[model samples]
Target: MECAFCTDGIDHCHGTLVVHPDGGFAECTDPGCADLDRIRHGLIIDCHAVDPGCGCVPHGSLGPALRRAS
Candidate 1:
């Protein structure tokens, strides 16, 4: 179908579908999207120090909402 990482849906999905040796499939050609996906899945740790400009801090929904309110 489309890249799961593509928040904008198939209309904007530019990644190609890729299948791994384990039969896992993913549509990821964008490096940033791939990194975010990995981080979200806990496959890679978010390095705040290295990417201090990152707005996606992995805070749960409520936490970010509360912070934004304050």
Candidate 2:
């Protein structure tokens, strides 16, 4: 899931978040945010963990289209 701090390119903070399917945060970027969420809700921020991507799109469909358009 996109961090509320940087969703839609908003706050410009960038980091990978590991979110469970049930809306729980397994990892987060911001220090203050991570600490607060961890203490309050048992949310964790495993800095070593990396988020690859949401995998919504298996591959880039735009590449071919853009090449043809150009």
Candidate 3:
């Protein structure tokens, strides 16, 4: 599935973290977010769970589309 976060902003999903589905993760705890449950919308700040094809993969792994593609 495509991440709306990135879809809303091109290349914005790169290098983000990959967060799993968590029922307790609706706090919008990530910085600069709003009062919304990101997981419910298939999203999490700095985490590309919906777009794993990018750099937001498991830790220590080669980040292909990771981090803004500097």
Candidate 4:
């Protein structure tokens, strides 16, 4: 599966779901991300981070790939 945040090949699923009271859904594996805001109304989804060799911290989001600092 392709990650929604980074659009990279997903090796594994995080099995976390953020659902709104109004029937909105967002899935994510990143524990650092706060889904409470999205759960209120909108949906915020986080995906497994892909190592792009940028040498950044291994966050569940694409922090390593998008970081300017190496």
Which candidate ranks first by lDDT, i.e. highest?
3
Model 3, 1-70: lDDT tens per residue? 9867677773332222333334343334345544353233333343333434334245534323223212
Model 1 quality (TM-score):
0.23
Model 4: residues >4 Å from true position, as ranges?
1-12, 31-70
Candidate 4 C-alpha lDDT tens digits along 7-62: 65423333344332234444444565554343322223223332232223234424
- Cα displacement (angstroms), candidate 4, residue 4, comes to 22
Tens-digit lDDT track of model 2 for 1-70? 6566445554332333434333444545555453433333323323222345344334332122111100
lDDT of candidate 3? 0.38
Superior candidate under lDDT, 1 versus 2: 2
In order of appearance, the predictions have TM-scores of 0.23, 0.24, 0.20, 0.20
Which window of ten consecutive residues has the lowest lDDT sum in model 3? 61-70
Which residue runs does candidate 1 get wrong by more than 4 Å? 1-12, 25-27, 32-70
| Model 1 lDDT per residue over 1-70, tens place | 7556565543232333222223243334455454323323312222222224234344332211111100
Better of 1 and 3 by TM-score: 1
**What is candidate 3's CA lDDT for residue 34?**
41
Candidate 1 residue pairs in backbone clash:
none
Worst 10 residues of 4 by lDDT: 61-70
lDDT of 2 at 19: 44
Better of 1 and 3 by lDDT: 3
